[model samples]
Target: MQRRDILKLGLGMAAVAWAGGAGRTWAAASGGSVAAGADTLDAAAWNAARQWTRTAFGRIAHVERGGGPAALFLHGFPLNGFQWRGALERLSAHRRCIAPDMLGLGYTEVAEGQGVTPADQVRMLADLLDRLGVENVDLVANDSGGAVAQLFAVAHPARVRSLLLTNCDAEIDCPPPALKPVIDLAREGRFVSEWLAPWQADHALARSPQGLGGMTFTHPHNPSDEAIDMYLRPLVDNAARTHAYAIGLDSNVLAGVEAALKQGRYPTRILWGTGDDIFSKASPDYLAGVFGDSRGVRRIDGAKLFWPEEFPDLVAEEARRLWGV
Candidate 1:
């Protein structure tokens, strides 16, 4: 079957199953207290949604809100800020949450014929923050965002109040064995699509039959069709895939992070998902060792790289505790 057809079928099945019996169970599993999609701050909730112009970096589509201290959410590569829907719902209640579609991802337009680099992406983020009138912020980042956040913190220490990382790759002397091959492939500018295709296909297949085993904290009783649709939407196009490859090939994110830690400017905290297959638990340990006595590392049980989706409440609770929001 074609990719789109397969996604449609998966989404249809997911919707029907979710609408029937699994809806209540899914909600309960996520944390009975909070409502699904209740806390998300979208274009509808914000006063205005605008595209931020950063001369060297290009335009970044972002949303802004007024209130408490600024909290900027930097999303992982391949996925857009939509991944933060669950976390945003809880966070938006107190602080103003700024979730932007990074360069070459989501609604943000990428520069034609130019591959997005880690340095350029970080610069765009800096520009986005400045354009929004945010002086300093509590940084929340995941996956590739961790590297960008680290660089931002190092470059602009005064602009960051605290750091919260989830399933991210931080600068450590000894990196995980699992990532070595992928990192090497990325560095070589090889066929990252072919390298990542198997895992991506497996993830798609896992949504059915065998189920979300080992992928999510709890078995998804009723995974939202819309959620699945949103997740798969980006992959349907070449622009998204090309950017994903660009991010994979960029080695500076890792190297830049290492350089930043050596600078010793900002305080950092790491929240890792033990079940994350992308970046192994060893990555966090390596980060802890690099930070030495100053930094903190905490592990989340029954969660994977995509912890926000698998255990939204747990992520929110942990962020709240760490950031004191």
Candidate 2:
């Protein structure tokens, strides 16, 4: 079947289930009681499981699961650690999974005057790991988080065991042209009130073609109502978060990191969604060429920018391959 057709079928099934009052919670085959949509975690559980750590950056919010070697998951722009809920559930058995909300985004309490650039995010992750007593970690990242992952690997090459990067900012397209309008809105400090506020008020609108679902998700109703609330509430609740997204995208933070990336020997794997329009198609190829220990790029047919949240199985599979687990 065509990808669009498959998506339609899934949406139809979900609608029918909702109409029939189907339960929202289910036991994942991998283990644990996951929320609807296969591997999702409900809002209440996600909120309750969060752990706060005090760092020089701020009071960082993160979720931890599993045991053994450490694996860190970085979420995309405007998203929190919740983006990796599915991957954490699946890969926790193999490695300790830790997903932290980036400063200025999610529920992380960022102190005033602190920067929210990719470089700053890299430093925040370093401090987070140090406080947690984790030395080296396998990195899994998507969207803008991918940019931070690159900076982290270069800044602390010894601390990265391997890298699994999905569609996001690369060296050439740090702030892709498609993001210019959003960046402009951020510059004006109107992104939260003008864009996210509507979505927070109307769940269906957020899932519509005009919002995040249409822009980044394969499924029209994806991110779910619960996820939409979880991801957007914090940003809209605070006025300070209005410009953070733009600051992070203001410049190409990955400009000079390519040379260092080529010199590093950390095993790397690139995953690109063919349907993503925000980033260049050549990016995955460019990244694969730059990494010294690249395992090549895997293209997900018809997937969009946020495919990591939709297809965590693929993320886990590639992570395991890169980690040689």
Candidate 3:
């Protein structure tokens, strides 16, 4: 048989299988239909962190599970708490895992006329921390969230117990070349309407390397459809939220953040995805220099932008050692 014939047969079988029994299992394992978001997570193995609280900012949404020292997870731009689902599940057994959908992302509702700048986010974080009844926390940060975490830790070192950093923006090259496309769109006021709207309309586009899924995880091709909707819709589909997030991204606001990391006092742990095309391999060391700590740098051999999603077990292991969980 020709190779094309064989490929056609395989596609036929896959479609047939998906139309029947195995598809159901895939859907269940992947958190149900594309709309379930984080709801369909298996409760037995997944701690299922869903809790909403009224904060001074608005009704903020967060994932909270387990009970011990507070371990707060911050997600990057264009994504939210959903990315930390696996880490939350793995570490919840020993520590309280709290992952929030920052200001305009996911289920975190941003109030009208609110700005989501890094400083604004830090203020929101403080308000949320106050409501969570915790004064200090072990913080884990990735991507744009890493910048936020750095600024927050530097400004309020008293609030952070330890910080675990993944691939993200450093002082030298903030967005990196590979990540500038989205930032560029935001600068022109065409992010939500042009970039995000089309991606949401086309599933394949959303999963392509040009979109969020491919930008996040590797090997698996793309994130489950549910994840995109949960993370993107809140910001990309809503004009207000999109505008809010874009405004924060449009400026050069990292001067204080750079100073903070260089001069701030905080315990730090470093995890970098060596295979990431966005943040270069030098990122981890650059971050270590910023934090003045080199003991905790560990590389995830082939993981990409969202390394935790690809290797949550490694993240959990490091968190266990770093936070003594």
Candidate 4:
């Protein structure tokens, strides 16, 4: 069949599957989503060392220090908790920062039967928080993590003290068109994982100077080899790829969060990287419409999608101002 026809059939099957409640089970059972490993922290010496915790849900890795209230960082797709390396270091000065590699990303152990869907990941996060003895937190989320953060905040509003979002798709109508094929292939458990593995590697490499001009949105110094390796570890591993794909396919959390927001209000803020090639800055307008009209909106322009890395100080300052840390 033509690729477009296959996609059409996939969409139909997905709709029926969702209606039949099969999608939920599929998410729950796609276990061992994140792989297990040692801390992937950069070699920078620190005032206090970062720590790792193995949770009932998966790996609960984070950097902690002198504390105010807790600030939890959630990384985006195809990236791990390490994505927040710069921000975590800065935030640790004022708040206890916990950054976890979502179920299928980073060095976290992939759970059995757990698909990478946002709902499943959010539940896993709740479980992880419980294990960590955290009651409530300020959440900073970027890219795909934004949707996960939204679901968490809506389902357990009291658990979220405040929210800070970067370039991420929060509405069903606004998801990047490029993601559809990836979602369909993931649902089918086909060679889609293999097909995308190289791309994942390419993206990681692109972060480097040599790779940056070729693949990234802007040119800067080449990213260290360690940085590239750390990013690619999860993608090259088959188990991690499976979980990542599953998560991508099951990302209905955006729709769910939007529906919930219509019922009530939450304190939210938006920061976007204008250079983001994946999800653009315009994506946050959905949140702006939902939360801005009443509570007011705050934006930090020119921060890339990986704002935590590109503009760590700005993220730290905005988060502190928002959280009153």
lDDT per model vs. reference? 0.56, 0.78, 0.67, 0.57
For TM-score, candidate 3 versus 4, the one ahead is 3
Which parts of model 2 are misplaced by more than 4 Å? 1-39
* C-alpha RMSD (angstroms) for model 2: 6.0
Per residue, candidate 4 scores C-alpha lDDT tens digits across 116-204 of 67777788888878877889888899767887887787788778878888777767534555456555656566433444344346654
- Winner by lDDT between candidate 4 and candidate 3: 3
Candidate 2's TM-score reads 0.89
All candidates' TM-scores? 0.70, 0.89, 0.81, 0.73
lDDT of 3 by residue, 1-325 (tens): 2323222111000000012232233345545432233323332222233678888888888877678888899988677776776677678778888999888777877777777887789999999999989889889998878888887887788898888988877776565655455555566777677667766677677666555555346554455555556656666657667666756764545664655666655668889877676666777887787774434588878767776665666888898888764
**Per-candidate total of colliding backbone pairs:** 1, 0, 0, 23
- The lDDT ranking, best first, is 2, 3, 4, 1
The TM-score, computed over Cα atoms with residue i paired to residue i, of candidate 1 is 0.70
The digit string of per-residue lDDT tens for model 1 on 235-324 reads 434534443545443353566455556555455677887766556556776776554223577887765666655555666677777676
Cα RMSD (Å) per model?
7.7, 6.0, 8.3, 11.7
Give the range of the ten consecutive residues with the poorest summed lDDT in model 1. Answer: 9-18
- Clashes in predicted model 2: 0
